[model samples]
Target: MPAPFRIYNTLSRTIEDFAPVKDGHVGIYVCGMTVYDHIHVGHARAMVVFDAFVRYLRHREWDVTFVRNFTDVDDKIIKRANEVGKDPVALAGEFIGHFHDDVGALGLANPDHEPKVSETIDGIQAMIGNLVNSGHAYEQDGTVWYSVESFPEYGKLSGQKVEELRSPDEVPGKRAPADFALWKAVKPGEPAWDSPWGPGRPGWHIECSAMSLGDIGETLDIHGGGLDLVFPHHENEIAQSEAANGKKYVNYWMHNGLLTMTSGQKMGKSLGNVINVRDALSQFPAESLRLYYLQSHYRSPLPWGPEALPEALAMLGRLYEARENAEAMGGSEPVEQVISGLGEDAKKVFELGQGFTSRMYGALDSDFSTAQALGYLFELARAVNRLANHKKAKKRGGPVVAPALAAFASVAETLGLMAMSSADFMAEVKEKRLAAMGVSHDAVEQLLTDRRQARADKDWGRADEIRNQLDEMNIVVMDRADGSDWKVRLVAAN
Candidate 1:
């Protein structure tokens, strides 16, 4: 049987035990990118959070059907395409390609079902027809609008009163201020689809409702998106889906928090502070970005900073180093014997490693507190490093740290961190950091080569000068018995 976990539901505003519609199965649908532009770091948060979440659930043996949709025919895409003098669908397709590239580089697992509004027009229209037949929606002037008053639970998801809300728009066809369009009428120059309400694209909120139901069922096990979406978008979804289907829209509403700047402002294109995922990945490892997000509670607003990736890289390096140290040890004695012989450091590592799985489960099961779960891994890493300092640990500590190794493997399996081998991790770090610093890897190697020759010739002063020169570029030169290796060092803030 799969392990049970709890998740925070935006609808109830409480963390609740997750029970799937079908036993041991989860059906989730998350609103994906609009595909008008490349996904920025802020967008990547939702991508990474849900990706890791699905990874975690599957790791615990839950059969998950994850669906993330693309709004390929949105107003934003049409406007952007017109501005760029391109066909709307073509522009969206271009950015969808870019989205895949950015998300692929970020090392995210693709959602099981990546539905698109353009591809699901029939399903979308059927849903709108259902709403119209049910009297929850009305057709006027070739446009269809959902009447908010028809559904008394209009603000149940967002907890906003309809009377207190401002007019959604000053559009002429809308019956009430809160009435939102289910099918938008054709405009002068925009993409149009043939529907009962005439030629127009699906409204923003209706796409998710239709897609979620078509991909999963009338009710989704969990519907997820950014916290920023909880209001009009998700709230309207609940209204339209339930009102039309006569069933609950979703059993659990899972929302990840937004990424905010140090000034407490959310990153947005309008703010001109959106950092594209490709640009961030160009300078840092994909895992660094993943760590930066997982370092905090999923529901906490992550503060994006200049040093966020660097600091996360340093933390990741520490975990890798500790795991590598534990892997370097050699022994086959029983774990208890090794622990008893190696003293408290060994005993601490053994107990912590033994207890780590349940503690990690406890944290992750309770609203997916990734930060708390990572804390346990960090504690285990620290214990491993401390124990490696003991004289006997290197030779006989393998038996004792075996469980610690398994703990690290569990992290890789569960969280998708530390997934790379230590050698690959360090090499990629050097490659990316060196590229970011505008330093040549081969040039650094040549310098190391020169430093080694100088040392061979007993030219201590010359070798020291080369080492100092490398240090100036934030590169650390490690001289070992086998050979000398160079690693790019992060700035002091890291």
Candidate 2:
């Protein structure tokens, strides 16, 4: 049986039971990008959060059908295309391809279905026609407008009183301030499709209504997007979808919180504060981005700062070090015997490791509290490290840490964290951090060579000087039995 989980519903404004329409199955639809430009770090958060959610669900044995759509033929696309002197469709396609590349670099899974607006035009028109025939929409000149008054429950999703809204733009034939456009009459230069109402294209909200229904059904198990979309975008979706289908549009509305700058303002391209995903990934491993996003609760506002990624990288290094420490232990003795011989530290690690899977599941199952789940992981990692400090731990401690290793594997399978081998992770850290800090590996290598020669010749003062210089550059030189290996340290968070 698939494990049960709880999720906070934006529509109900409370945590609710996530009952699927079908047994052991969930159909989820998330609003995707407009495909007009590169995806920023803010956009990457939504992508990573939802990707982790689906991966977790599947890890619990639930069959999930996830659909995220691309708004390829939007006004923004047309406007950007005109600015760049390229065809709108070609421009959208270019961005869509770039989106895939960025998503891949960020280590995200491909959504089960990525429906596009231009490709689904026929279905969009059909949904519009259904609204018109059902008296839920009306034709105004060549454009179709959804009648907000026709649906008494229009404001239930967003909780905004219709009368409080601004007066509708006088587009020559629009009836009311609250009634949104269903199908826009195409402007001369914009992309056009033949419809019963005339030559026009889908309105912003209606495209999701049609594409979601086409991919899933009349009602989705969960619908998700950024918290910013809860206003006009999601509100309009609920009205048009439920009004036209005569059924509940969605069982749960899940909106991830937006990223906020340290100044308490939301991150946006208009503000010139956006960090594109490519730029971020070029400086750090993909897991650094994932850790940075997952460290906070999904519904909480994530604060982006100069030390955000660096702090996350530091935290990640801690986990990797502990895992490596545990993996390095050598023993074949039974765990009970090893624990009996090693005392409290061993006992703590064994207990935490044994309970880790259940505790982790408990945290994640309760409203997908990734922050809480990661709390358990970090605690286990600390326990492992503390146990490794025992003198006998190197050779005789493997049995005691076996369960902890299993716990790490479980985390990788379920949460997609710590999936890489320790050596690979450590190597990636050196490569990205060196480049990010503009430190040349060759220069660091030469310094290490000079330090080794000074040590070989018993020149303590010269060796100490070289090590001190490396420390100034945020590098830590570790002396292992094999040799000296150095690592670039992440910045400490304030």
Candidate 3:
């Protein structure tokens, strides 16, 4: 049987039961990047949030058709192309390639349909034509404007009054302050297509409505974007889509919160404060970035600081340590017997492990609460760690931790965390951290050789001094029973 779930709908401003347009299925549309430049951590947050939501839904057996559209034709792309002396279309294509690489590195699953605005020009024109014929739009000069008054529910999604908005520079052809363009007439040296109105390009907001309806029909189960889009961009989409189709545009509106800098301002390309995903991934594991984004509620403004990645790496290491400890246990006794012998801590582990799946589903099913879901995961990790401290755990505790192992695996399959093996994750950490710290393997090995000789000669004073020097360089040297292991420390520099 398919499980029932509830999602917080931005359209209704309430948490409601999610009854899809079709049984056992979901249709989700997310506004994708404009592709004028490389994707930043701010953009990656929305991408990862929706990607994990889709993965969780499918893990619970719901059939999902995810559609995200790219605004290949946009004012920003045109402006950027002009400044760089490149063709607008060619520039968009190049950034789209870069987008795929970054998202692939972050381990996001590709959407079922990645519609591009340039390719869906026919659908956009058809929708514009319908709007004009229905008296919801009119052509002035060469531009088509969507009449705000034509759609009675214009403010339903955004809750902003048309009369309250302040217009930027107004063109003479627009009928009202709130009305936005449906089609922009072709300009010299710009991309355009032949249309009934004129040779023109689709407007930014109209392109999404057209491509969404063209791919997923008149109504979508969910339409998602950053909170910044909820006002002009998404509000305009609701107007154009409903005015043309005479039906509800989207059943649910989902908006991910924006990323704010330490200064409390939202990151944007125009602000010159954006950090590209390529730059961040170059210094940290992809999962570290994923964890940083998933640590908060999708709709809450997440703060970015210099220590964010280092803190996330620390948290990720804790989870990995718990998994490694669980995997090291060995036992065949029945769970009940082991718990009975081991007492409170063992019983806690067993109980938490048994109920983990339900707790995880409960958190995810309620408004996609990744924060709460992660809290439960941390609780499970504590239980695992407590059980591992048992004297008999190494040789006789595997059966006791069996359910906990399954819980970790379920997290990997559902949330895309802890999917990498311990060895692989450690290796990635070493490679990335070494590069960021500018420390080489050969240099570290020579330092370790001297330290080993100092210890062998019982020169405790010299050995301690060498360890402090490596510590200052953000390297940790571990003296295991058989050998010494040194690694790049994940903590931030003081």
Candidate 4:
């Protein structure tokens, strides 16, 4: 049987126990990118959050079918295509490719179904036809608009009464301010499909409703997107789907909070404060970006700053370092025997490691509290580091730290962090950080060579000078009994 978990449902505004529509199965639909441009860090939050959530669900043995849609025929795509002298569909396809590249670099798994609006026109038109037949929608001047008044529960998701809401735009054919377009009448030079309402395209909100219904079902086990989507996009989705299908649209509404700038505005392309995922990944390892997002609770606004990735990378480095130290221990004794001999630090590590999974599950299962889960991992890492410092830990402490090793492996498997071997992680960090700093490996290696020769010649003055030079370049030298190695410092130099 799959383990049970609770999640915060945006509709109910409470954390509720998750019950699948079918036994041990979850049908989830997350609103995906608009595909007009490369996804920014703000967009990546929803991507990473849902990705991690799905990973955790699958890790716990839940059968999940995840569907995320692409708004390939949106107004933005047409406008961008026109600005760039490209066909709208071609522009969407280009950015969809870019979207895949960025998320792939971030190590996100592809959704089970990536339905595109262009591909799902049949379903969109069918749903609009249903809404019209049911009197939930009306057509005028070749445009179809969903009648918000038909669904008394229109504002149930967003809590805005239809009477109080102002129309988003002063379009001519709309009968009411709150009523939104289901089918947009074709405009010249824009992509259009033949529909009963004449040649037109699906509106922004209806694409999700229709694609989700076609991919998942009338009712979804979970529907997720960014918190900013709650008001209009998601609220309209709920209105149109329920009014059309006569079934609850989504059982659970899950929304990830936005990435906010220091000035207290959400990072957005419209706000002109967006940072593209491609640029962020160019300077940092993918896991650093993942860790930065996971460090906060999924529902909390994550503050974007200059040092976010660097600080997350440093945090990740500590976990990796601790895991490496724990892995280096060697022993064949029983864990209890080693713990008894190695003292309190060993006992603490053993206890924390043994209790890690339950604690982590407790945090994650309760509203997917990644922040708390990461806090537990950090606590376990600290304990392992303390145990590694014991004199007998290296040769006789493997048995004592075995559970800690397992804990580290579990975190890697569950959270997608620490999945890389210590060597691979260090290499990636060096490669990326060095490139970001515009420092060549040969240059750093040559300096290390000079410093090694200086030390060999017993010239402390030259050795210290070269070391200072490397330090100026944000490189740290580690002198072991076997020789010397160096790394690009994880944090910025003061």
Candidate 5:
């Protein structure tokens, strides 16, 4: 059996115990990108949240089939193609390739099935045909409109009522203002497919309804998207799928909160505040971006600003530092003996490390509380750091911190964070962050060499001067017993 866990269901507006459609298995469908442009950080929040959720389930030995779709045919794609003088299909295809590149750089695993709206036209038409046959939809002037009134339970998902709702698309020949399109009549220049009504394409809402039903069955184990999609998009999905299949649309509705700006508005492309994932990956290590998303609860609004990635990198550095310190200890003495000799710090590290797994699981199993799970990891890290401060820890504390090392390994396997070796992580940080800051590596190295020579010549003033110069360049030099080293500073110099 799969490990038991609870998830917040947007449909029920409460956290409920998760039970899959099949024993030891889950079938999830998440709404994917529209494919008109590069995916932004706001879009990546949904991607990373679902990716981590699936990772945790698989780590607990559950069989998961995850499906995310592409909306390759849309009004936005057509508009963008027209502006760029390219075919709409070709433009969407270009962005799909870019999407793969960006998400791959972010270390996201591909979904089990990536259904596309353009390829799933037959499925979309079939479902619309069913709704029309069952009196849930009607056709006029080669356009099919879903009669929202036919489904009395239309408002259940979004708490919206038909009388109180106005259709965002003001197309001609709609029976009611609240009724939305199932199939749009093709214009002279738009893409079209042959359907029962005419040569028209699927509407934005119906493509998801059909693709999800065809891939996952009549009812999905979980249906997920961003919180901004809860209105007409998700609500229409529920109406169309349930009305056609005569079954529950989804067992649980999972929605991740949007990334919000400091001005208290949601980040969006139209708002011109969007940061593309590729642009972010160019400056920060992929794991740093992952850490930024995982630091907040998936259901909570995450704040975005200039300091977000920098702060996340700093936090990641601390965790790696603690793990490095724990790994450096070299004794084979029993942990109890080391604890007795080194006192409270050693004992606390031992206790926290041994108990870390259960504490982490307890947080993750209840509502997938990543924030709480991360809190426990930070607490363990602090304990290990404190124990390392003891003078005897390096020579005689290996056994004492062994469990702590195991705890760190567990976090990597479960969360896809800290998977890189400490040395590799530091190297990546230097390469990317230095390039981002426009600092040349050879210049920093030459400065370090000059500083080393100045120290050798007993020129304290010159060495201090060079140190201050490097500091201005956002570099921090470390003077150690073995040798001197430097790193790109995680925080901006004031």
Candidate 6:
């Protein structure tokens, strides 16, 4: 049986139990990129949030059909193609490939269906035809425009009254200031398609309406997008879809908050302060980026700073180290018996481990509180670390820590954290961070060789000196009981 969960609906502005359009199934459509450039960290947050939500719903046995679209035909793509002296379709295809690379590196699952405006032209035109036939829209000089005044519920979703709205100046053929274009007449040097009205392209908002209705039916269980799109984008979608279908557009609306810079401005491509996902992945492991996104409530405006990824890397390292310590523990006895012998630390680990799943589910089910879920994981880590400090832990505490060990495994399977082996994770951190810092591998290897000789010759002073030099270079040398190992330290440069 699927678990019951509640989500914060933007339309209702309240948390309510999710009742699907069809029992045991959810149809979700999220607004995807415009495909004009590489995706950035802010964009990745929306991607990861929706991806994780879908993963959780599927994990809980809910049948979910996730649809995310690509705006391959848009003003941005056209302008960018013109600037680069390339066909707009070809330029969009280039950025679409880059989008896949960036999101794939961030470990996002592919949507169940990824529709595009270029491919969904027929559907878009068909929807516009319906609106025009139903008298909800009209054509002027080959352009189709939706009469926003015809929909009495225009402000229902956005809570903005038409009279109160400051609509843009009337365009040449639009009937009213608020009547948005359903289809734009063909423009020079742009992608075009045949339609009953004329040869034209889909408008920005109408594409989503057409694609969602065509892919998942007239009403979606949940329609999601960034908060910034609530006004003109989502509001327009509601008008077009409802007017055409003569039914509800979406049962629930979900909007994620934008990532804000430290200066309080939003990180957007238009803002020119965006950090590209490709650049971020080149500097840090994908998990570090994932951690940075999941550390906050999905609906809260997350602050991006010089220390964002570094802080997240530190948090991820803590969880991995705790898991490693738990895995290293050893014992052969009943858990209760071992706990009784090992005292309070063992008992704490045992109790917290037993309750870990419940706490995780509580956080996840209640508005997908990733921050709270991680708090519980950190609590488990602390318990494990405390138990590992016991002198007998390595040889005689495995049975006691078994549940704690299982907790980490569950986290890996469920949340996609601490999924890599310690050695592999550290190696990836070194390679990515050092490469990002422009450090040469051969130079570091020679320094390590010199340090090894000093240690072999019992020149402890010389060995320490070389280690300090490497430290200054942002390298950390770990003198293990077996030998010396080195890694590039991940921290905020600023």
Can you write out model 6's per-residue Cα lDDT over 400-494, one digit (the tens) per residue? 77877787887766666777889989888888888988888888999999999999999999999999899888998998889988877767455
Q: Estimate, for each residue in 300-378, the C-alpha lDDT of model 2 and write its tens digit.
A: 9999988888888888889999999999998888887888889999889989999999999999999999999999999
**What TM-score does each of the candidates earn?**
0.97, 0.98, 0.98, 0.98, 0.98, 0.97
Q: After superposition, how far is residue 120 of candidate 2 from its true place, in Å?
A: 0.6
Model 3 C-alpha lDDT versus the unseen true structure: 0.91
Deviation in angstroms for 475 in model 1? 0.5
**Worst lDDT window (10 residues) for model 6?**
410-419
RMSD in angstroms, all models?
1.3, 1.3, 1.3, 1.0, 1.2, 1.5
Query: What is the Cα root-mean-square deviation between model 4 and the actual structure?
Result: 1.0
**Residue pairs with clashing backbones, model 4:** none
- Cα lDDT of model 5 by residue, 1-494, tens digit: 67899999998899999999989989999999999999998898899889999989898899998999999999999999999999998999999999999889888889999999889999999999999999999999999999989999988988987777655776679988888899999998899999999998999999999998888899899999999999989999999999999999899999999999988999998899999998998899988888999999999999999999999999999999999999998898888899899999999999999999999999999999988999999999999999899999999989989999998998898888888999999999999999999999999999999999998898999999999999999999998987789998997844
TM-score for candidate 1, please give it: 0.97
Clashing pairs in 1: none
Off by over 4 Å in 6: 492-494
Error of 4 at 141 (Å): 0.9
Model 4 is weakest, by summed lDDT over 10 consecutive residues, at 162-171
Best by TM-score: 4
lDDT (Cα atoms) of all candidates against the true structure: 0.91, 0.91, 0.91, 0.92, 0.92, 0.89
